[model samples]
Target: MCLLFRLYFLARRMHLSWVKSALVLWRNIMIKVGIAGITGYTGEELIRCLYQHPKVKISSLYARIEKPIHFSSIAPRFNKKIDLMCEPLNAEHMGDNCDIVFLALPHTVSMEFVPFLLKKGKRVIDLSADYRIPKDSYELWYKHEHTDSENLTQAVYGLPEINREKIKGAKLLSNPGCYPTSIILGLAPISKLISQCLIEPIIDSKSGTSGAGKKAEASFLFTEVDENLRCYKANEHQHIPEIEHFLSYEAGANIKVHFSPHLLPVRRGIMSTIYLNHESFSSIENIQKMYNDFYKNEPFVRVRPLGKFPEILDVAETNYCDIGIKFARGMLIIVSVIDNLLKGASGQAVQNMNIMCGFDEKEGLF
Candidate 1:
C-alpha cells in the first residue's frame, strides 16, 4: 500500500516538472524587439503594431534625446498601452536588450547604427534608403556618401511578396521605400510581359504629405499642402532606380520607368498609376487573371476585380496593397494603393521581423 502511494506522488511530481519546463520554453519564444527613431512617424507606427503582436515584447525605444522620457509623452495615443521610457540613441544598449532592432531613422542615419547592431549578433530591419540600392547609386541619388558597403551587399530587400524566402533567412533587411513599394508591387505581376513587348513605362504616383516625414518643412505646411496637388519630382525621383532595380530583377531584363511623384493634399496613403503599352495580344481578362494568380496566395496584396479600380482609402492605415487593372485604348493601366507609413514603412518592417523570426507572416498585421 505504501509503495503504491509513493509511486502516485512521484508520477504527479514528474508531471508538474514537465509542465513547468514547457512554460519556461514558451516564455523564451517571445521576441524582444527594439525601435531606434522612436519619436518619428514610422517609429510610432512600429510601436503601435508591435504592441499588438502576440509573440513580441517592445523591450527598448531609442530617440535623439538627452535624457529618457516616457514613450507616451512623445506619442499621446500610446498613453495607457505602452508605458515605457524612450532612451537616448545608443547602439550598444539596443543590441544588448533586443533580439531584433528596427531602424526607423532617415536615409543617412540608419547606416550609422546598423553595422554595430549586426556585430552584436542582432537581426536588423532598416526602414531607410541606406541599404536598398548599391553604393554608387545611393551617393548619386541621395547625395550622401555610402559608409556601410560591406553589409549593403548582403542586406535582403524586404518585400514579402517577392522576397519572402530571402527575408526568412535575412539578418539585415533593407525595407523598401514608400514609392518603390507601391510601384514595384504594381509592376511585378506583368514584369515579364513588359520586358518582352513594352517600351519604357510611364509611372504617375501621388503620395500623402506624411511620406515626407515628421519635420518642419515649409512646403508640407497646412496652408501649402491643404487643397493643393503639386508635381515636384518628375523623371528624377530617387526611387526611380530602386523601382527599376527590383523590377528588372523580376523580369530578368533591364526595366526603366519615367517616374513622376506628386504631392497629394491628404495625410497618409500612396496611389501609383502605371501605363504599360504592350504589343502582344492579350485581353484585359487575361491580364486580370494573371494578376489574380500572381497575388492569390499573398497575404497583404489584394488584386481588384476586372474593370474595377482601387482608391487610397481602400488600403489606408492597413498593411494591404490593393491593385487594380484596366486596359484602355492601347495602354494597360495598373493602379496600386498602400498606406505610405504602414505597408510602405513600419508594418512591412514588422512583417520582415515576423518572417526572420519564424512567426506567422500576418501575425500582428491584421
Candidate 2:
C-alpha cells in the first residue's frame, strides 16, 4: 500500500510538470506574418527586422509573380537565416496562414491587394503612397486613379510619434514617406513656432540611391550615382504635397513646403536641411531647450547639443531620427537624419505593427 501511494503521487507530479511545460510553450507561441512585394528594398529590410523578432514568425512572402522562388536566391544575405520560399500573392493562401500582412509593394500595387487582404481579416501596414493621403489628394499627386477610397478613411498615418494612439486601434496603417518622415519629425516639435512665426520652410533633402527601390534604372546605375550630385523634381516632387499636408495639419495653419530632393552617392540614409524664415529667431538656448523638452520622453528622436548637428552616420542602420537645430542670421535651420530603409520605411512599419497588436513599442526594433 505504501509503494502504491508513492507511485501514484509520483505520477501526479509528472503530469503536473508536463502541463506546466505545455503552458509555457503556448505562451511563447509566435504571431504569424505575411509580406507582399517581398522583393523590394523595404521588404528585404522588413524581413531582416522580423527575422530577429521573438514574437513573430514569417508565414509567407509574396511577389506578384508566377512561381515559387527561394528567398535566398533573391537576397543572398538571408540564405541560412530564413529558409522560407517566396511565393505568388494569393489572398487565399496568405489569409489561411497569417494574421498580419505587410504591403511593401509599389504605390498602385498595394491598393489592389489591400482590400482583399483586409477582407480576409488580415491587419495591413502599407508602405506606399496609396493610402497615405485622401483619395482626391492621392489622385492629384500620384496621377493615378484611386480605387480604394473606402479603405482610405480607415488608414491611420503610421508616424508613431504623432499618431501613436490612433495607430493602436488602426486596422490599416499608411506608412509615411522617407522624406516626409525626416521632414515631419524635424519640424513637428516646433509646429507652434511654425504657425506663429514662420513664413516658409525651404527643405533641401538628400537621400541615397536605395530610396529609389531595387528596380533597375539608368539614373540609379553605379556611374550615374557614384560621383554625381544633382537635384531632380525641384519644386514638384511627389512628396511635396505629403510633407505640406502633414505639416499644415500639425501646425494648425496653411503651410507650403518648398522642397528639392537630391540623390547622394551612398546606399541609404536621408539628411534634410530645413531653412525656416521666421518672424524672428529665438535665442539659441531657448530653441535648444524647447526641442529637448519636446522630445525628452520620445524613444527614437535624438536632439543634438547646441553647436553640434546630426550627420547621416549618426542614424544609419538604426531606427532612430537625429535632429540638430541652428539659428543663422534670421533663419532657423534644422538638420535631421535617418536610415531611409530602417526608420523611414520598414522599422517604422514594424513600430506601427507593435502598436496595433499591443506589443512593446520597441519590440523587434532595438
| Tens-place lDDT digits, model 1, residues 1-366 | 223322333433455675444344443367788899987889988988999999898888899999999988899888988878999988667767777889999889889999999898777899999999999999999999999999999999999999987887787999999999999999898888787775688999999999999889899899999999999879999998899999998999988889999999999999999887775525888788889999999999999888799999989999999999888887889899999999999999988888776578898896
Error of 1 at 1 (Å): 45
Q: TM-score, each model?
A: 0.91, 0.90
Give the alpha-carbon lDDT of every model: 0.87, 0.85
Q: How many angstroms is residue 82 displaced in model 2 relative to the true structure, after the best TM-score fit?
A: 1.9
Model 2, span 1-366: residue lDDT tens: 223322333433455675444344432557788898888899989998998888898988888789999988888988888888889887667656777789999998788888888887667899999998878888988999989889998888999888887786677889999999999999898776776764678899999999999868898999888999979999899898888888888888877778999999999999999998765566878888888998898888999988678899989999999999988887788999999999999999998887776577788886
Q: Which ten residues in a row have the lowest lDDT in candidate 1?
A: 1-10
Q: What C-alpha lDDT, on a 0 to 100 scale, does residue 117 get in candidate 2?
A: 83
